[model samples]
Target: MRIATGDDPFVVEILPETPSTNAVLAQRARQGAPEGLVVVTEHQTAGRGRLDRTWETPLHSALTFSVLLRPPAEQVPAERWPWLPLLAGLAVTTALREEGYAAGVKWPNDVLVAGADGDRKVCGILVERIEAATGSTSGPGPAAVVGIGINTSLTAEELPVPTATSLAIESGGLVDRTAVLRHVLRVLFEHYADWVADSESLRPAYVRASATLGREVRAELPGGGTLVGTATAVDATGRLVVTTPQGDRVVGAGDVVHLRPAR
Candidate 1:
């Protein structure tokens, strides 16, 4: 199906298959691809998620794509770059909720939608930074490849995990993949523009839509320790702030598991 691009900067390229959309975009970024270019594939042979995890889905059962972004460091400070993935999660969650699904963003990258069993993961986001090749200095400084995967038409039995879900499963029927893609991309681009203009303005809305905030959680740190606490907030620099028994701890990178409902 055709992805309509009426007066938008997005140039969508659809491939029947690929190793990974993010990988493709990263290569193009290193070669100086423009912002708003999107690469989509029906199946990912080597899909990747955060924490170097494998993310695979049956052919034609998911919406997988990556968008190239070249946010100028002057317009948006380098320090605020971490907000890209979080803003993306907010964009996806907002789009799904607007489509009539109960959606909220889980910290640092996953989108959760309420299901009969519980809040199951419906989408995953991964942002990768690619610096320009040596002596290139062609266009922008560095580029960011934002990869997003959404479970669209998979059946319950076909789900990758019991805690994962698809749009069709939640809606109890078929879904129009093209329409969903268009809606999500539009929202995502809007958020991207808003973020470039003023990153701080996006924080309140993101906090309100966060499913992890005020919830008891366990954060698995990158270097090997774990922290159990109440996820108080997502700080200005996009780190997860957990209020533990010892005190408040800031986590810059880690996997967060929701241990209890939001308080």
Candidate 2:
């Protein structure tokens, strides 16, 4: 499928340069922009990864973009909002696998490919929630700004970190940014729409494409604790289920570091 350039459900806006696609779309959402607004930039002066870390890629070397989502409360329960990023990760994993790349989802929203050292990250996702106004009986809404950044054409030296690899680097110097963008959007939107209707089909695909499963992991929890165990599965709500010594536990948010490769 070509980029959703025509009159389609998705309204894709391309920019030659921007500080961050998420920033642009967040402003639009506050201004009452409709759902399905996608902002893709060729360059980002202030791109960010999870936990507010900086993510920089050379101009035209990556697919950097954000999509706006306003999930209806009546259709998607509030508790399921955390699954948005996980679903997006699954979509990207599927798209890359179709392109003949051995991609896998690393919990929450990281897409990774195995490397000589470990699982090198190729994609990072940040999902920001925008809360609705208070004291309005006619209100119960929040928009999600889903930012996806993928390393496409970066050379080996240009990688942001030793644990980061680009598609060009991993695939022996062949990559297509436009096709990647189109495939990503098509898969993401299709799965997202279907998920909003049922919210049940995501886990099976995610589990199948996961790199964290069946591996020893140490999750750095957000509350200043760490959970170490084998990542056995992902529950229906997309939380990682770990078989820790304290018994089976579910981690809703964390930075998971795989201590061993998937068996």
Clashes of each: 0, 0
lDDT, model 2, position 233: 88
Best by TM-score: 1
Q: Candidate 2 regions off by >4 Å? A: 1-4, 133-140, 222-224, 254-263
Per-residue CA lDDT of candidate 1, range 1-263, in tens?
33548898788989899999999889888887789889999898789987678867998999999999888888987888899989899999999999999999988768999766678999998999899898975666799999999999999989988889999999999988878888999999999898889878889999989988888887665556668889898889899888988999887754443333532
lDDT tens string, model 2, 36-60?
Answer: 8899998988998676888667899
Candidate 1 lands at a TM-score of 0.94
The lDDT values for all models are 0.86, 0.84
Evaluated against the true structure, the overall lDDT of model 2 is 0.84
Report the lDDT of model 2 for residue 199.
90
